[model samples]
Target: MAGDGTVEWGEDRPVRLMDRLFGDAGGGGQRLSAPAAGAAVVALALFIAAELVPWMSVTQQQQGIGPDLPSQTSDVSLDTVGWGITAAYYLGLMMLLAVVGLVQVTRPHTRRALTAAGFGLSAAMLVLLVGAIRRAGEGGQYGPFDQGIEATVGPAPYLAIAGVLLVVAALVISGWRPVMATGHRRPAPADPDEDDDDEEPGPIDLTVTPA
Candidate 1:
């Protein structure tokens, strides 16, 4: 029994704790709206496409001062995989986060921690992508003759930027909350009719009525 004259069940403590940490435990917390979830799905799809397509293009040209000298040009393209392990690892992590977010979107409750994590990771990925573009724009040179080399940003990087923006929009629309499962159940309301019926009858008229 509680000081308020109410009985406290063994499960009440944990329920209250969960409610305090993650909003209403009875599934009343804000969730990812349908339209927002759709946008997130599209964003994830764009990110995947970005990984598969070329992100950068490199062109190398060689020329000699002599009129008889022959000139040569070569072109190379690099995708997410071509960036090496660091880029690959980041892509994998982002994909995993996307999957988790999708699962949460399907549920009724939301977890604040997961939502915050998704936002942080997505933002980090965007930063890395932008940095890669900036470095590529500077270009590079090779050989003693200083052979000219030009690096150009590909469509894939731009696509990734779009995806990241969409992800931000989705998170904002959903209020930065991810769905989570909880064991809390609201107590059922009492029935007044049942309470009245449970009362004992006053006095059974035992006066041997008229014979």
Candidate 2:
């Protein structure tokens, strides 16, 4: 408000930028509810754990030339953080940004957008994991061994999928609007006597009157 009683819309450059990115402070930014916050935390933990754990395992077997010679077996495990660093980095970044947005952003629309983006990223990760697992299953021959390799999907991918579902759950929980209760009793009618009593006594007779 200005001295002239008109509303002022001017803002500093940084403040404008902040409002554009995070949200308007005057709007009273949205924050995650308890259940939604818990779900998000769990999802983040699951994603981190998934990155640490082995996502897939490949086993190679070589048959012995003769009965005297022994067969050889080797195993290779793929980890998200180790082999899929790029994907993990992006997913982690998205999750972090989502958490930050949920906590700090004031605009409901901005929060919703962040939640949607997080859910999309999580779903994309799951899809990539499924595709990778399927591709791994179609193993090719390696080295001089005639026998081909076998690939098995590991627990890490499933954990990641679980995390993705949780992310969606969090988003749903956050956006859920509670139904407002109705059927309140109306106020009782105002007393006419009370209204009469509220009236002010006006104009005392000041002129000299003969009784």
Candidate 3:
């Protein structure tokens, strides 16, 4: 009960919720670079472009009797399925991080960041693996080692290694920056006085005493 026009309140519900969520945020906080995001977007665009446009060609050889042989050139077909999957993966990753950044959401915990990266890479790799299986099933000219290398080189093994490398590269690129340490231990700001003390040198005694 208050006689005055202004009434005293105990606490605001929304304020409490916000404080819990953002931990009494004091400043604008760490942010993702818009330029970096743009770069990612451009790279994704290039990948899509390469997939859509006829950018590469392959050569085929034919054998004929009497040494009459000609080299045949053909435009490389799009790995439509594989390229689409890769495009989606890149776009999805950019969108995921962009939304988080735009919303001012803090970077996820390190473990979660790594896990997301791993999972995304695995999903992409799974798509490629499926495609390779289909190619094998279709009985293409691909030899026993049809994944990438010839029969002399193991295709399946190379593809697996490639997938692993992709995951590692993505993980490194996305999560290399330092963050709040594992224990949330923030670095203490340097004390101004301590800095001055370091900058100034102590006096040297003129008389030297031998020990």
Candidate 4:
């Protein structure tokens, strides 16, 4: 109860820590912007497409008794590594980014966190991609390729990287904040007027007069 205490409206309610920083940010359905939303969607699409395309390839020649013997040619795609490559791991991360991006499009309050998350996820992808490449060299052969072979980075992985970068950029550009009307306040209950009868006098002794 407050010092002057007229019941201290809403005093009993809990306040979320986030509410203190950004205020209530009106939880309405307004979106960030059409271009930003479109970019997010496009990023998702590009990521998916990149996953399906070839990302790496390797070639090797087998020694034969005759010099005229032909060497075999082989190629591999991003799907070749499956979950082994960091690029493959990004499929799930990209999906998560897509979901967060969609929410940010509609919920302005989430932009700050969403932008941070996107950047972090992208950075992780880059680190993993480099790790995957390094691991390929350590084994004397890239993933799934024959020994003593050098794997060439393919266009698909590059495409996915580009897509992830775009998502980060899109998030940075989409700035929005909704106006918070007011902090939660309990409504004041109406007080009874002194002029109003508290209770009706028992049905006026009309029946008692006959006795």
Off by over 4 Å in 1: 1-32, 63-96, 99-103, 106-110, 140-146, 175-211
Compose the digit string of candidate 2's lDDT tens values, residues 141-166.
23223254555566776786787788
Report lDDT (Cα) of residue 200, candidate 4.
Answer: 52
- Specify the poorest-scoring 10-residue window by lDDT in model 3: 148-157
| Winner of 1 and 3 under lDDT | 1
Task: Quantify all predictions' global Cα lDDT against the true fold.
Answer: 0.58, 0.56, 0.42, 0.59
TM-score per candidate: 0.52, 0.53, 0.33, 0.56
Superposed on all Cα atoms, model 3 deviates from the true structure by an RMSD in Å of 17.3
| Native-referenced Cα lDDT, model 1 | 0.58
In angstroms, give how far residue 90 of model 3 lies from its true place.
Answer: 9.3
Q: Name the 10 consecutive residues with the lowest summed lDDT in model 2.
A: 177-186
Question: What clash pairs does model 1 have?
Answer: 109-179, 110-178, 111-178
TM-score of 4: 0.56
Candidate 4, residues 3-89, lDDT tens digits: the string is 332434334767655455334434442434444556677878877887676566665656758777666555665445444564456
Order of quality (TM-score): 4, 2, 1, 3
